[model samples]
Target: MRYSRILEIVGDIVKVHVPATENKQTAICFGDLALIESIADSARPPHLSQVILLEGEEVSLQVFSGTKGLSTHSVVRFLGRSMEVTFSPNILGRAFSGTGRAIDGGPQLNDEPSIEIDGPTVNPARRVLASHMIRTDVPMIDVFNCLVESQKIPIFSVAGEPYNQLLAQIGTHADADIVVFGGMGLIFDDYYFFRKAFEDAGVLARTVMFVHQGSDPVVEGLLVPDMALAVAERFAVEEGKRVLVLLTDMTAYADALKEVGISMEHVPSNRGYIGDLYSQLARRYEKACDYRGAGSVTILSVTTMPGDDVTHPVPDNTGYITEGQFYLHDGVIDPFGSLSRLKQHVIGKVTREDHSQIMNTMVRFYAAAQDAQQKQAMSFELSEYDHRLLKFGELFQRDFMDINVTMPLEDALDRCWQVLAECFSRDELLMKDSLVEKYFPTPADTLSQVDP
Candidate 1:
């Protein structure tokens, strides 16, 4: 039986108060998908599109574009389910729009199981320990602060910094078997760069992309990540593949959600965002899971601080939901403010023997050097130790901490030892005696240093 169209609205929401019969009552709820077809002025043109969403009996359909030409009595059909993403090996290397529909003009992926987007998260009790490591070839990340598999982390950067380049580089270099790239509110340049670079790197075969450009309906941005993750979860759990999910500018994603929440006239919370801000973010981040019986999803998300204010609601709420954050500043990862809470999980277990010890010693002295720099700037009388610390901090920043300092983990740690020896004696550095003897260069040993 066809349903009758009852009312219409302008903002992508169509009201369909269906007439009911004894045993043929309508069974539709909010968030179920609905197909809408509209014919305006019958002679001019007709608008047709797939199910967008169902709110009560009123099916709110995104009319591809908006309902600019839609009129009353336009036909609507309920799909009886929500929008779903196609999950299969074929989905990799393909690009889709926010609605899980292909944008690259490729053949439709109809073979994979169609699972609902934004499905229930993994059970907390069933989630396995995040023990494996995801090696990103970037030295500042892999060596200094390791990214653990199944870890949910965000890079906090300003708008002008190279966070996009960093994300693309990681996608090109990550050791994961599969990568799901989700871009929310990307401009044309950024969207094109990812496609070109991934193709050139030959990693495009194992990757999937879902993009929502700036001009697309803002609602698409909110759904892009969920669409990507829906496919990723299926790939990981079924194929036992290590998957890395990369998301750029999640702030735009959140803002898109907040915009919809505002359109619905929901009550405001902190910073004028909807009250469910934290829950919305957690729903996406919680998708980063390592299935005990199969594979995993490790999330590396980008959350840009508006006006460089970390206290902005978008990032402030993200900091709470994610495992930890990579605080990017001035085109480099700021060691002083940046931290990886799960760095300890993999430092000694998955990495080299001296990784944990070297990481501990380097950050500790780097802190001391910061204080020495402050003293010098204030014109305080500098002591011998202060002078040495000043030199150590400068060298640390120029060598290990900068993003351009790309090297393997072992080389980065050996460089750390060289930086330490130039400023302080082996005993004063206060490391494990055995580790020092094994890894640290002796007085007679020749070690390379950053030429001052």
Candidate 2:
């Protein structure tokens, strides 16, 4: 059905007045797509839009291409459907805009089957417990906080941090069958970096990106996550492929929501964001799931906190919805701030027997190392134990905490033993005697090994 009159033009939103039907039902529902065409100028191309708000006899649509050339004398044609994206094997190795159109300059996917985006999440009864781990070859993650399959977690950081580089590293090394990436408000340099990283690592063939550059319309950024998750859900269910979805800078997404909400004259909540901020974010994060009989979708997103404040609305709300978070700061994943609520499920079951003990002992010693360093800074006379702790701390940061250090899980565990042996005796470990005897390095063994 086509409505001829536009009531208001505010930002990218165009309000149209639609007459009630005989039954007095809504003429158009929210989320439905519409095409807005200028009535006086037929030469202008129609702008694609989505119904964002609906009131009595009035419908508001968000123009994906902005409302610059639009006027009040425009026609709104409802499509009777929500947003959708193409889904097929061909999407692999391709890049798309937030609107689901090809932006990689490759062939269009018009022939592929189009699947509706933002569908309902999987039923709780149909979900399986997340038990398997997704190895990223980063010891800080693989050893300390395992990325359990189907877990939804975020890298909490501030602006100017290496969060994007960490994300790119994970995307390149993660042991998932397919990777679906959503980049919101990314600059051209960052976008090119991700593409080049994947291409150089030879993982682009199994990767798909849906990007909304910084210059794109704000409304488009809101669609990037939905489009990426929609395709990931399809691949997990239909093809039985374990899909890893990476979304960077979700703060940009929330900001986009705030912009649209303000344009619509809605009442603001915290920090001038819409009242349903938590619900809006939960709707996306809850999409991470492990199907009962099929594959799974693990979501790893980046949420930058303003001013490094954990109390910021974006990161605060995300913390509640996600399983846990990786606190990335100073180019390293902070062991104390990072936690994986599901790591217990896989630490011992899927990994080495000493995995759990090594994790606990390493963090405990690192904590003591921090204390020792504080004492040294205070100009207090350091004890012999403190001296050993200081050495261990340096090695810990250099070997495991460094973001650039890459090693397999077993090799990382072995390196942990080597470092411990160099600092303290076997009895100092306080781990299980069985594990200590089996994996602990002896003096002769330590002497035989050369420093890398």
Candidate 3:
């Protein structure tokens, strides 16, 4: 194979100067992979890199590993292909690096057909309208927000929050056929937490994880989402599986993009991020889709806000692309700020008949409780109702809103009613009479339960 000479090396980026005559015969395109051969030491294995930019005869590449001990005269062999990941059922229960290499001391993946990552999203015409709900068994989400299938939602959170823990819980409890996790810039502890959580929950057999640690190659960080989504798409499209793709700390992913953009000398947009930040995020989120007759792919990602700023570029841009977001504040999913845009389509239709009414009542009482707490703090005399609100609020946080609480939707709905009955009278709830009559506890009902 013919080779081109490297003209310059900066950090992980290598600039190869190709002749106009050679370019005509062997065209170099963006996203194409290449091998950098060491002329100085021919014994060393060829380093892998990808073409990130192309202008006339000057092509720039981002080396996967750092370009250390590399020379300008190194031979550049264009692979004429983009990066790909092996896609098959064998990928389940396996852990891979961001670049799709096995990193969990597992056996090497056998010869499986690989598919290119970062491809275009499935066409809208082929997508079935998302009308089904994927139950995560979390009251804050399943009851209030109602995670619809094929919907793309985010957990907008700040650092130090249990966002990763919440994600692991969801992966353990979500009812999808398979769970695909993509972690960017995660610490070793965070990575271990996910693996242990999945293993303990016995879901590891149906889960796949692609992790990019804080110390891994920066370029590999950019590939995690693509590798995850590519495999997820294959499972949904080919294997007919309901796949849930969970990504934690997309802010780190955006930071990696900014770093690469800066090295490439591209003009920065908001907060030093590349100009196409929204498009870049949308490309991945749009991969969530429901096939016509097969299963669907639902994306629930985490976009951590730096300094708890909602206007930060990562979450700011994410808000526009996702159907809705769960605001994880103070370790609880804030109901007032969280919403699911497509929830209405499934709330009453797919969920239980009383799901909507119960959800509304729970959130309403919680809001009232917050107001009562504020009134108490301001030294205002509390009404009898205010005291009840306070009690209800405490119970809500303890039993329903806590991220650790795991129960079926029906059980959670019953818990909501019990909290209401213990704190307030029947009339105070103002719920649908049919539901109140059906689920509300009465004096006799309470007595019968205690005696037995």
Candidate 4:
């Protein structure tokens, strides 16, 4: 391949001057990987880069490594390929950098074949509509907002919330065959916490982590989601494994895009983000598909809202792409804002016959409890129903809404019944008489049963 000369350099971006005769199809194409080398001094190692923009004979590239001490005389060699990562079962239990290099200090993988990152999604005809649920024993998720298989959802939270803790809990207990984790702009402590948590749970053998710490390159941060989803697709398609992809702090990913976009001199959109923010987010989320006659890929990501602003470009665009979102507030998943759009597909069909009625009733009572608490704060005269609502709220939170509460779906349902029976009489529940007869405890029966 013929080499080109570097025309200019600007903070991790290099503009190479390709000859007019260079083939547009074969050379100087967008997304093509290139190796930049300083010709004046042959000792400097070659830096990897990707073509970000092309204008006639001028091609702009974003160097994974910042351009420092490099002259205009540097030679650029196009690799004729885009970014790729190794895919194999060996990746499980292993940690990799955003660039797909082994960061776990283990032996490098040699037998795995490379798959291109950010490829087109699976065909629509090949995808089956999501019909199953991915149970993560968390009460707010499993009991209320069921996590449907192959559904794309997010945990919308702000800084300082225990979103990471919640994510770790799900990773440790979710019933997926494998978990693919991608952390963007995380601190070293957060990285260590995730690794240690998975290892302690003895689930490292079934987890793959692609971590991009805050200290890593911005370009690397942008690659984490794509790399993670690509490997997940391969596992579901070839191995017939139910895969769950978890991404933390996608807002960091968007920020990386804005940083790179500014360096590339591209026009900005709302909040100074790139114009393709929505498209970029949709491309990644759309990969959550259930392949026909094969396994499935579900995405449960954390798209943190800056200052708890839902109108932020990242979360705003995400709200349109994902099926529904879990609102993590003050270390608890707020059931009011949290919803699963596809939960209806599996509620009664796959779950218990009482699942629908119980979920609605619990939420309705919780709303009433909120009003009762507000009335108490104002020193309003307390009525019998108001007093009962206050009692119901406390028990519901302690037994079910607490993030630390871990129980099976059936147990959670049973616990819900116990809470209702303790606070409200049989006639006030407003539930079906048949369901009440089967699940709700009579006064005599309630005296025999204790807190679960």
Error of 1 at 236 (Å): 0.8
**Candidate 2 lDDT over residue span 1-452, tens digit each:** 67887899999889998876811553466799999999878999999999887787788899998998899988888888899999989999999998998988899999999999979998878799999999999999999999999999999999999999999999999999999999999998999999999999999999999999999988899999999999999999999999999999899999999999999999999999989999999999999999978999999999999999999999999999999999999999999999999999999999999999999999999999999999999999999999999999999999999899888999999999999999999889999999999999989999998765
- Please say which candidate is ahead in lDDT: 1 or 3: 3
TM-score of 4: 0.96
| Candidate models: Cα lDDT each | 0.80, 0.94, 0.89, 0.90
Of candidates 4 and 1, the better by TM-score: 4
Task: Answer with 2 or 3, whichever has the higher lDDT.
Answer: 2
Candidate 2 weakest lDDT stretch, 10 residues: 20-29
For 71-104, candidate 1 gives per-residue lDDT tens digits of 6766666666766788877888999887777888
Ranked by lDDT, top first: 2, 4, 3, 1
How far residue 373's Cα lies from its native spot in candidate 4, in Å, is 0.2
Ordered by TM-score, highest first, the candidates read 2, 3, 4, 1
Give the better candidate number (1 or 2) by lDDT.
2
lDDT score of residue 3 within candidate 1: 50
Best by TM-score: 2
> Candidate 3, residues 159-192: lDDT per residue as tens digits?
8999999999999999999999999999999999
Candidate 3: C-alpha lDDT: 0.89
Error of 3 at 189 (Å): 1.3
**Across residues 429-449, which tens digit of lDDT does each residue of candidate 4 receive?**
899999998999777877887
Reference-based lDDT, residue 437, model 3: 92
Name the lDDT value of residue 197 in candidate 1: 82
In candidate 4, residue 403 scores what lDDT? 88
